[model samples]
Target: MSKDNAPATLPPVKRRNAELVMLGVALAVTVSAFGASGLALDGSLPVGMFGYGIGFIAITIGTHVALRFIAPYADPLILPLAVFLTGLGLAMVWRLNQGDGDHAGAGMQLIWAAVGMLLCLGVLFFLKEPRVLQRYPYLFALAAIVLMMLPILPVIGIERFGARRWIGFGGFTLQPSEFAKIALVLFLSAYLVLKRDVLSLASRQIKVFGFRVFDVPRLRDMAPMVVAWMLAIMLLVVSTDLGTSLLMFGTFLAMIYVATQRSSWVIIGVSMFLGGATIAYFLFSHVQLRVMIWLNTFDPEIADNEGWQLVQGLYAMAEGGLLGTGLGAGRPDQNFAADSDLILVSFGEELGLAGLMVIVMAIFLLVERGLRVALASREMFVKLLATGLSFIFAFQVFVVLGGVTRLIPLTGMTTPLMSAGGSSIMASWIMIGLLLRLSDNARKPAPQAIQDEGATQVISR
Candidate 1:
């Protein structure tokens, strides 16, 4: 028990090397999946496998090197996890393409992956301080509104599957709502940071027989929430895009809850959502059809018609059972959107429950690390921004999984990083870049205090 025997303080370690190693492992897994899938389908390795692996390795190494210069102290697991999910998605898209003899989808997805990584790098390079984004809440809000409205415009807007949520540019289509989700999160984080004190502490209470019942914010103070709710309703009514509507509003509610830390806000938000959904259900045939399909998926009445996709997806998973039919053996393409919105089902049918669990766990870990960064953040705006981003990512996954499992009506939202959508990939990487920047700020060691000999004065008695 001598003082000299105490352990010396250890230096802080920035695990950039650890991140590079994990990225290699992630790349190996993806290449292996591609190779295995090709052999199973064609009795030989895929012709494109080598090219795909090389391209992916280049992107991964480039991204890792950029991170070393831009954000050396960022969380290590995030990039690897995102890459693994995206690779799996690309593999599945390629697998589906084999049946149709159209390689364009897979080719386009790979191109988008590269584009997404470049955009991610841009974020780290240009956005020197994440807090700078907090200054333009109204600007962000306006951008979000414009992005959401893009698909409904006459010239560029294009309708598909009864939902007008895509805008055509050249021969390709883009979903503006995905980008809008990010902008809205920024706006919400900034707005909530400025008003959290009042939202949390300045609520008026209603009393019942000497006991306080519920606290309500003032009408003037409730404007933001009211506007968000109304915007969500408008999305549903105009675009008939239930997924985006629910996602935008759900993120808003979640950010507000994180900012204010009040259960009443959540209660009020959920009540408002239920009321809006009920009204939409009565007024919109699309909403009613979705609810009916959810409730009566197996019914012969619609099973062969409107519910065919859900039924086929369920049967595919059931057939997959515990270990799955192996990567190229399942008929996942029989279900609609096998490579996009129902990607989880596609994965389940081939990889089985165990494989599906791995994907789900990867997403869960990403969210957990994001929240940890939020907790470590020193600034209120950064904390709220990180929290909102994490919650939205988690909530989007939940909405997709819930719809596929029949736990809720289908909302048709793409799974982040695991869907064959350019917008989803770009937005996912943008959020990842933001998380990396915030994490760097959170974990960077504070500047050591400097001592000046000239500043020291001797006191005389």
Candidate 2:
């Protein structure tokens, strides 16, 4: 074809390049944080700087390279944002562990991060299409159930702090609920995609506050949402994990809203959760203590036991003020779950409000990009999956940070990528993998479609 007759197409996006550059910056910041910690704590270079830097750069750069090959058109912001959070978390964990006279926690976190990245790579390698998961919604749902149930078993269920939320085998304890969340999202997305029409159109019409609201779903239509609610409630009852329950239910409700374009589902979901939580608070001592502690954190009676963690966190945040205390100089060890639940408060104490805001903004960007991917996708299944996964981050962050800041009752939810749990890290990276794949499908150019002898053949380059 002549130059004038030749096809014209825009150049492919430089998303991978952008990710690489941002990853570099994130790594540098992590190293700088370590340096600052060392200088403040012992007046020398931080311990294990070279080893940590090498491991971080290796895993992150390798992950970026994998993305270039598998999801070249994926959103640029997700990878770097994840690395940034992980790096910051590692820094915080390392600094906090310095007071322990052992390098175990930070070292374990690094190992977990590596394992998580490997899982992410495995996802990219195996899951050719995110929509493929829609074919087995029931399977995913069952897996989620089993995962939730595992921690309640008598033999392997390991109890800690009055809750059996972990299962220990072969000396490595695992929190199954963290990974169950992905399966739950998958099942919910697939279920909603198939039922969106019925849920949105087949419901009884209801008007409230003089405005037409959602149509009440049929008993059959309501079954799925009911099951989801029951499962969340069951999880709360069995594990006494209010945070996971809220996160799961909230994600399900958000996906329902997106799928059906109905706000009533969200209202109903939130109200139901609040009612259940109120009931639990009155009936369960642990639940009641969390609420009481949240309400009266400074009470001299329980302040030494249930409220001590939060009070110390508040004191640390106050000490840091708006600018933080420089990485290694603060005492996050005074708070319980300093490396997981209260990590944000720890960061706030040392990095100050400014650094905390930076972290929050980074998280906001990651969530925004996930939502954007959902909007960009054409398939209902893919859209709902992205939305559900994205909302997990939004809800989890709010739950953890709000608890730490005393805005809400403390629950045992860990910040994604910024927490010390292996399951949380792996689950988060898996979510990133799905997001990257979905974003790739969203932004990648369509293949050529050809027609020959009543058959159309398409080829992807």
Q: Give per-residue lDDT, candidate 2, residue 360.
A: 91
Worst 10 residues of 1 by lDDT: 449-458
Clashes of 2: 2
- Work out the TM-score per prediction: 0.94, 0.93
lDDT (0 to 1) per candidate: 0.88, 0.85
lDDT by residue for model 1 (166-261), tens: 999889889999999999999988988888888886457878998986677766777788888999998988888888998999999888888887
Worst 10 residues of 2 by lDDT: 449-458
lDDT of 1 at 251: 90
Score candidate 1 by lDDT. 0.88
Note the clash tally of each candidate. 0, 2
Error of 2 at 37 (Å): 0.7
Model 1 quality (TM-score): 0.94
Summed over model 1, clashes come to 0
Pairs clashing within candidate 1: none
lDDT of 2 by residue, 82-171 (tens): 999999999888888887776888889999999998888888789878888899999999999999999989999987875678999999
